[model samples]
Target: MEREESNNNNKQHFSHKHILTRLQLDEVEEITCNACECDVEEEQFYGCTDCKYFLHEECAEAPRSIEHRSHPSHPLTLHAAATYSNQSFICDACGYVGYGFCYSCAHCSFDLHLFCSTLPHTIPKEEEHPHEIQLVCEQEKLLTSDMISICSFCDAMNTECWIYYCETCNFGFHLNCMISKVVEEEEEEEEE
Candidate 1:
């Protein structure tokens, strides 16, 4: 009986009781991650059929606190809801306004999107570039002129999107551009 009890305990400890379960496409009706607020139609996701809680597998597994290079002064804590009265948050990393799960610093009022928080520190240099591109967090200060900061990769004016910048070369890239570039590279590698 003691051996059986021990086995049960082990199973309980190893089981994904708290983890979300993957659902079939047919099973995914209109569920979305409470964390990132992204719909299941975009990607495969995990969810609770009973409680109706859902999360992107990545969002569900995000670290409770992270020591991001962008906010080196203190570690940012993951928050399911904003503690402030504004009911919204603007990402310091990407410059986009959102109302969802965020990595936040209460002391500094710094916020980052889940996807922005998980961005890689460095990316391989594009064929046109001579050095590896480094990610830098730049705060968008109010400009008096109508001019806009342009993305080094796409040559488009940076508006609400997050930017990855290299201090050494003064190069910048929009978050979407970087993500797409990485995806394209991965697809090319898979083909090769």
Candidate 2:
């Protein structure tokens, strides 16, 4: 292999010593991120274009370690990709089977998606609701196993996901439905 270097700040200092260039992928069908093992769609990602080694920009810059609030028992370590035989892990925060860019607690075998692990504690009332809403990812503490959670924002019921809530007034939103703070009408506007 030939040694190469670059002066780009965003793609600098990676665990692997490879020359990665920032790219805006076009209408790609099935390009996958080597780090996270997820599909690399038409978005800004970092990779060696010639080698076909790709990484989501978020995955490329994910912190090596984090002190996440949801799992205070131990600090989670960022893994470039799952090392399991099945090549995936169930996300503890959202209860979804995820591939790529997982934060794992080796001691407990608990894992989380990079996006789910970083949800903010509270959304201000000014964003989209009357009262401040808090994200609730540790669902076992608040919800009964038999009951399903419903997103007040979209009226979608889900058994495996986190919710954002305003404790004062009981407003709720699923992380998936409101992660971008996008409402249904906004989606409709884009289709017009």
Candidate 3:
């Protein structure tokens, strides 16, 4: 476990056969993290520049397994990437295709992206929705409509992912949409 602060050239990560060196990107290219299979969004990450193998810092630190609320019957094990014959998986939480680090239950075929696995069970009521929103996962159906429904927050349709929903308000949005935005307050009142 090499600390990011050290900037040592021989960081030992379990994912790769070669030693990863710390790197900072001044101008990022079309690089993707081998671990998460997502575009390299971080300016600083560990990489084997020679192999073009990279990992987002968070991905490098992910636990090997976790007890997730979504799949309560069994603990999900983390894999560096999809191990299915197809080498791909549809994230149960986001309803999107993924080819990177994922938490899965092999018996149930349930899969979740490393990022999606961390979403809170509930996002408290907000002024925009006026009611508490709870994360829902089950048979693929949106409660808002019998037919496909567009996300209230994002213009996309419910594409078979878990959602933050408010049945009373008949409101729902994808986990990606809810998380991509700044949903938390940023300021506090200052009394002089």
Please name the candidate that would achieve the greatest TM-score relative to the true structure: 3
Which predicted model would earn the best lDDT? 3
- What tens-digit string does per-residue lDDT give for candidate 2 at 1-192? 332333353465354567777766666345788765557764567777577677777778778999887778899998866657897998877666777678999898889887777778888888556888777776573466433356775687764677777777656767777744554666689799
Candidate 1 yields a Cα-based lDDT of 0.66
Candidate 3 overall Cα lDDT vs. reference?
0.75
Deviation (Å) of 134 in candidate 1:
1.2
Candidate 1 per-residue lDDT over residues 1-192, each given as its tens digit: 000111121111111355455644444367667787766554455555566666665676677889987778999998876667987898776666767789899899989888788777787777877778766554433122233447866898755565665556767788777767877997899799
Better of 1 and 3 by lDDT: 3
TM-score for every candidate vs. truth?
Answer: 0.63, 0.70, 0.73
Residue 7, candidate 1: how far off, in angstroms?
18
lDDT of each: 0.66, 0.71, 0.75
Model 3 residue 28 distance off true place after TM-score fit, in angstroms: 4.5
